[model samples]
Target: MHPLISAADLRAWLARRPETVLLDCSFDLADPSAGERAYAEAHLPGARYAHLDRDLSAPKTGRNGRHPLRDRPAYAAWMGRMGVAPGVPVIAYDRQGGMFAVRAWWVLRWMGHADVALLDGGLPAWQAEGNAVTADVPAERPAPAYPDLPPAMPRIDAAQLQPRLGEVQMLDARAPERYRGEVEPLDPVAGHIPGALNRFFKDNLQPDGRFKPAEQLKREFEALIDTERPVVHMCGSGVTACHNLLAMEVAGLGRSRLYPGSWSEWCSDPSRPVAKGAAA
Candidate 1:
C-alpha cells in the first residue's frame, strides 16, 4: 500500500470501515496549543488529535531540538491509547501542508507499524472536497502494550551524522530562504549544516496541495542525488523533514535516515560548522 491516501479513498474507507484510526496531527510551531484548539473546533469525523509538543515529542533538554522524538515505549503506549495497534491501518493528517502529519506517519513507521499512511494533501484536501467535519472526539480504546518492536526506519544522531557528512547525501528540507541563511525565524541560528543540499519539502506537493506523481518526484530527486545513495533528511526542528522522507518513500527512492535534532540541535553546539548560501 502507498504511504499516502487520497481524501476520496479515505471517505470510502470511513463509510464502510468506521474502525479506521484517523489521527489529526495538526500543529503550529508559533502557537503549540492552536492545533488542539483547532481540532476542538472542527476536524475529520472520528479523527483523534495528536499534539506535536505533548504527544509526538519528548521533553526538551537543552540539547535536542524543539521537537525531539518521544520515547519508544511511551510513544507506542500513546499510539495504543489513540487506538493505533499492531496491524491497524492508521492514517495521519494535518492542516499545515502535512508537515506534522508526516511526523506522525514517520513515528508510526519507526515504531514498526507497516500499516500506517498519511492523508494525501492533509485536512485542506478533505475540506476542499466538501467533506463533513465534526467537533466530536472519538472515544479512546483500551491501550495496548507496545513490546520491543524493532524500528523499521533509519535515524542518525548528530554525533553519527557529523563525520558522515561527506559520505552520505544530507538533504535539508527547509525553505530556500532558510537554507540560504536569508531568514532565521524559528531557530536561533540561520544557515544550514555544511554539505547539506537544499530540497524544500513543499516541492513535493502540487498546486492543489496533493503530492506530485511518483514519477515526477523520482525525477526531481534523481536530479539531486542517486536514488540508491544513502540519504539523510533534516529541517529546522526535524518536523518538515519527514515530508521529504515520506516523499522519497512514495517515490520508491528507498529508505533514508532522519537527523531528528536538525538545525536547532546542530546550531546549539558552537563546534559544528554552519554553511551559508546554497549548496556548491
Candidate 2:
C-alpha cells in the first residue's frame, strides 16, 4: 500500500468504515505546548491527538536525542491506548506539511502495522478540501489486539554508523544552512555528521508543500546516489528525517535505515566528528 492518503480518500474511507483511526500530530519544536493547544481548539472529527514529546516519544535523558523512538513493548501499549487494531486503517496528519505525520507513519510501520499511512499535504489539505473541523474528541476505545512484533523498519545508531561512515550513503536531512554549519539554533554543535551528504528534507515537497511526484523524486534521488551504497537518513533529532524516508518509500525505493540518534546525539559527545561547508 502507498504510504500516503489523500483527503478525499480519507473521507471516503471514514464514510465506509467509521472505525478508521485518525491521528493529529501537529507539533512545534520551539513551543512544546502549541500542538496540544491547537488540537484542543480545533481538529478533524474523531481524530486523536498525538503529542510529539509525550505520546510519540520516550522520556528524554540528556543523552537521548530530542524525540527518541519509544521502545517496542511500551510503544505497543501506547498504540493499544490509541485504538490501533489489526485491520483498522490508521491515518496521521500534521499542520506543518507532513513533518510530524511522517514520523507517526514511520513509527507505526516500525511497530509492524501494515495499514498505516500519512495524510498527504496534511491538515491544510483536508481543510482546503472542504472537510469539517471539530473540537469533539472521540471516545477512547481499547484495542488490546494491537500488534507487538519486531520492527519492520530499519534503524542504526551513532555507534554502528560511525565505523561505516565512509562506506554508507549518510543523507543529512537538515536544512542547507544547518548542514553548512551556518546556524546552531537547536543543538549545541552546528555542523553535521562527517562524510554525510546534504539532502534537505524540504526538497521532497513541491512549491505548494505537497510532495513532488514519485517519478521526480525517483529521478532526483537516483542522481544523488550514483553508487549502490546503503542509504541511511538523519536530521536534527531524527524527527524530520522520517519525512525523507517516507519520500523514498513513496518513490518506490524500499524503506532505508535511519540513524535515530541523528545530529543532536552525535554532537552531544565531543568524540564524534562534525563536518561543515556543504555535502562531503
Candidate 3:
C-alpha cells in the first residue's frame, strides 16, 4: 500500500529513515514567483523546491492549456536532475491542502513510481503543529541515467473527446460556477466539456482542509466510473485537476490519464465546441 503520512507519521519517519525525500511544490497561478520566494524565505528542512511552471510543465503552446505536460523523456531527465532515482519514497507538500503537491504525486505515478505520498494539510498544517523550518538550499545531485518512458500516454484531444462523450467517463474538477458557465475566473470561456461530470477538487477535502480517507473517496468516485472504464481527469488549467487524480488513487480507483490543457486549452479556440450546465 502507498503510505499516506500524517504530520506525526512523517515526524516518526524523519527520525528513523534517511531515504525520505521531501519535495516542496508550493505554487501560485496568479503570482508565479511567489512560491519560490516563499520557499527561499522559509521551507521545511531538507526540502527542495519543484517549480510548477518550469520543472513540471512544458512551454505554452498558444492553443494548448496554460500548463501542458512536458514530454515523458524530458520529464524523466528532469527527475534525474532533481535526484529522484527509481524506487525512492517521495513526499510532496504545498501550502494548501495538497493542491499543487498532488500534481507532483500524479506525474510520478504516471511514470510508474508507486512509493510516493502527499504531506497531509501541507505547510500550513506542518507549521500549525510547530514543525521545523529552514532556509537552507538542498545539495545538488550527480547526474544519473533514467529509463526510457513509455511512448503512448493515454490522452484525448477535444475533437476526439467529443466522440467518446458518454461512452467513457470524463470528469471536470473545476468549481460548480465555472462548470455551469455562471462565472469564469480564469478562462476565456466559462463552461465545462459536454458530458463531463462535476466533482470540484475541493470536495475531496475534509473540514480541516485535508483530503478525506480512501473509503469516502472510493464512494464518491465510484458514483461516476466503475473500475472497468478508464477515467479522463480535467480542470480549468489542468493544475488542480491533479487533486482529483491523487484522490482517486488514494481511493483505490486506480490510475487515470490527465487532459493537461483542460478547460483553458479546450476553450482557447473559437472553433472547439463548448458545453454549459451539468452533464445530461
Model 2 per-residue lDDT at 104:
86
Task: Return the TM-score for candidate 2, rounded to 2 decimals.
Answer: 0.97
Best by lDDT: 1
Pairs in clash, predicted candidate 1: none
Deviation in Å, model 2, residue 236 alpha carbon: 0.6
Residue pairs whose backbone atoms clash in candidate 3: none
Ranking by lDDT: 1, 2, 3
Question: How much lDDT does candidate 1 score?
Answer: 0.90
Tens-place lDDT per residue, model 2, 223-271, is: 8974355799999999899998889889988779988879988888898
lDDT of 2: 0.87
Which regions of candidate 1 deviate over 4 angstroms?
none
For each of the candidates, the C-alpha root-mean-square deviation to the true structure, in angstroms, is 1.1, 1.2, 2.2
Distance from true location, Cα of 93 in model 2, Å: 0.3
C-alpha TM-scores of all predictions: 0.97, 0.97, 0.91
